[model samples]
Target: MPLYLTALATLLLTALSLGPSFAHVLEAPPRLIVWSPELWREATVFNGQFELFARIGGPLDVAAMLAAALLTYLLAGERPAVWFALAGTCLLVLGLGAWFTLVAPVNAVLDSWTPGPIPSDFASIRLQWETGHMVVAAAKFLAFASIGIAVLGPRLP
Candidate 1:
């Protein structure tokens, strides 16, 4: 029961932390890919706002996952601790990895960009950034599914 409570708490925190980022993802990418340079510049300012939110929000997500992992380790007696740990860890890794490797670089590029001319490689960068979002979403979905299974698996007949 304690483990279930912890997992639920973690799940809720994850959702809270990710909610802003998800909003940005849904609204930003497709339009960004199509925007003119002047519009892109304006959008970059908006993106910066979300970046700040993400910076503030991401650590909370990681902390919640850590708490979940610790709870699973300490309280999951006779339950599949390994499964919970893997899911939780995978979620952390996928989110952080995408941010650092994929999103961050493109953000840096966008940050430095001026409003006159779009860079030649901007399309490719946008593709990579969007792809990173997709990958992160998929990983998160899998992790959530795995956690659900682990939490409920032993209760089933």
Candidate 2:
């Protein structure tokens, strides 16, 4: 069981970390540049990379959720194990929910954006989009960290 938990935790951690890692590389640097519709549109183009990452990472969430469920079932009657499983499951839910509600809408708009003149409302929309991504990244990082702690916390001492 410990080995199984360790393996699952590693996979979940790696999967969750990808969001922030990619965001840092792809999204963070642009904030340092002058904000413009053209700039924003260019940034939108780069977001396609993130979309690709999401397509791959999205399925891992389901695997993590199932791991939690299986852990709960296997460790039935063990309070800590059950709680950890619940925490892992809840964190996944929160992270994915934020992604869909906060990030996906922005992604849709970005996908349609062209390279020409920027839209008048681009700044406001970009702010929302960037802010939404930051929020989702934080949620995912927390979820990953929580799962790690839950799985490995006891063994530490």
Candidate 3:
């Protein structure tokens, strides 16, 4: 029962954490190609909305990582389930690593911007940010799939 609960929690948290990354990926096509001024305006406006996501998402991401780790442990001796859980946990960690290394630095720059002239390097920064999210989304999607397989795969007893 505890194993089942942990598996469910891992799946739910990982699925939820994918939301913001997926949102960024969906918006990247249009956002990436827009004029600097337009992108600046959109970025500033969109940045405000992310406060809510940050508050909710930060803990959720951490929770998902922990849950994946826990699920991996709980599934020990369960053959392919344990292997899949381990893969899912590693993918989640990889996603978080990409977020910190790729996304957070650009976020710091974006957060520091004012209403004045957009940075000359805004395009590069935008590219970094968007690409980071796409990478994160891919990692997270794979993590979710791996975790799901762990939970649903045949048990070895």
Candidate 4:
């Protein structure tokens, strides 16, 4: 019961945290791929959008998963539940580590990237980093969503 409550709390928070990013994204001006300046701005916006899954909100997802796995462990007396918790913990730790080592520094760069008269080299790097950010964001979202469904889907009754 405690685990279920904990998972729900985390899910609610995740939903809350992601809401504004989605809102900003939807309201953003349309862009053309050929326009480098516009692309730069779009890149910046996309980078900001990536924040939800790569930051602490992501850890919340893992924590929720761990809580659910532990709940299963406690209730069912099953080895799978224990395994799931351990797996989820490891995933979260790795995700956190990757965020610190790779993504966070790039995020700082993205934050500081002013939106005027970008150099070709700067644009290239920005695009590359932006692509990487998207990849990580997708992975994190998938992890969170899968864990959520795995834990909560069955309990939806």
Q: What is the C-alpha lDDT of each candidate?
A: 0.64, 0.63, 0.88, 0.50
| Ranking 1 against 4 by lDDT, winner | 1
Model 3 pairs whose backbones collide: none
Looking at candidate 2, the ten consecutive residues that score lowest on lDDT are: 148-157
The 10 consecutive residues of candidate 4 with the worst lDDT sum are 24-33
Prediction 2 global C-alpha lDDT? 0.63
Clashes (backbone N, CA, C under 3 Å), per candidate, total 0, 0, 0, 0
What is candidate 4's CA lDDT for residue 8? 64
Candidate 3 lDDT over 9-120, as tens digits, reads 9999999999988998888787766646666556544557678768988898999999999999999989999999999999999999999999999988887777767678
Tell me which of candidates 1 and 4 scores higher on TM-score: 1
Model 1 Cα displacement at 144 (Å)? 1.9
**Residue 132, candidate 1: C-alpha displacement in angstroms:** 1.5
TM-score of each prediction:
0.75, 0.74, 0.93, 0.53
Give the per-residue Cα lDDT of candidate 1 at 124.
76
Position 131, candidate 4: lDDT: 47
Residue 150 local lDDT, model 4: 43
Candidate 3's C-alpha runs over 4 A off are 34-36, 45-47
Task: List clashing residue pairs in candidate 1.
Answer: none
Residue 143 error for model 2, in Å? 1.5
Candidate 1, residue 10: CA error in Å?
Answer: 1.0
Better of 2 and 3 by lDDT: 3
lDDT tens digits, residue span 69-118, model 2: 56556545655655665676676677678778977787778777776677
